[model samples]
Target: MKTSTPVGTQADQLQVTEDGKPLDAVRGTRAGDLDLRRTVLWWKGFEEQVVSRQQELHGIGEDVVLAAQAADTALQESPPRLAGEVFSAVAEGFSTVPGEVPRLLVPWFAELARSIGREVSTRSLADAAGAGVTAVQRAGAPPAGTPSLLDALVPAAEALVGAEAAGVPAVAALHAAYRAAADGTRRTVEDGTVDPGALLVAWFFERGTVV
Candidate 1:
């Protein structure tokens, strides 16, 4: 993975090789001393001396594929984004570039926008649901999933489990009546389970059915 030094011009090539020999990789070998700098005069001399230097050293002496690979390497070595950095970068890219593009890149931008929004939206929903649950608990309302009478209604949910259960008036109205009665009474009955898990399930599900 030894790359030619970073000389971005043609003349630099000949000067680097003016003695008419290839590089001696061993001469500069030193641990933790990679990406070393060459003398300015060396670079200047290379710039003045080379004939096909830029092309010769184009992307570290590699061809087009090598050039692309070098670019990819550079990109890999580049810093990674912080939490907001990527979004900001992509958003800026999206804002600035508003036209047809390389086919490979379109889905990238589209997916970024979609995932970002979806993540944000899902995060918001989770926060809201959490807050809603907390609020209900604080208000001493039964949790949202089932009604307070859920153990009383497990027989109900199972009895009227499927859509066909919807046709059973007794089963259907059973949930309806339970909900109706529960909705009317938030008073924690002295002997009753204040807010059963089943209660939340029943209220949310049955309420949805009725609506």
Candidate 2:
């Protein structure tokens, strides 16, 4: 029997490409040099454009920082089974008894569906939410013929509903929804469909009016 190459080693030797061109060819530079330059530039841009701006906007207040830290810690400590139960309840509720959705949330859901290349409507959203709930309750993979984007939308819907159930403040619930949508965008990108940046921007534009 032949032995297989280690996954990590194979990944390390894999050549990543953009538009079918190797990074070096695309950049017209040595790959290693380009990689280092890109890494440094990304870090600098993140610090200056994200961290600095956030600090300025939030004033680096201890209360805000502590609250954020606490949330992160709680999320990290949550057991997967418990989290799944919470997500399942939210999904089920949306599918069965999503009461009088605020008018604002509909547009956000429509935009999110459109961003993921799906037609949007109350019925379709309810169906997707129902499918998600069924999948969770069965403790198995999603049913055959399930749309791929459900992998993202289910969690995004769960986050929104869960926030509401927890009685999170309105502003915080909106933020949670946006964050969940961002996470969903990331998942689609990893699935090799949807432009991450474009989807993220779509979510951001809808964020203000959601919840």
Give the top-scoring candidate (TM-score).
2
Count of clashing residue pairs in every prediction: 15, 0
TM-score of 2: 0.28
lDDT of 1 by residue, 76-147 (tens): 454223322232233233333332211112232233333333122222222233233333344344333333
lDDT values of the candidates? 0.29, 0.32
Weakest lDDT window of 10 consecutive positions for candidate 1: 31-40
Q: Per-residue lDDT of 93-118 in model 2, one digit per residue for the tens?
A: 22332222211122333333322112
The lDDT, on a scale of 0 to 1, for candidate 2 is: 0.32
Runs of candidate 2 with Cα error greater than 4 angstroms are 1-148, 190-206, 209-211
* TM-score of each model, paired residue for residue: 0.19, 0.28
Measured with C-alpha atoms, the lDDT of residue 58 in candidate 1 is 22
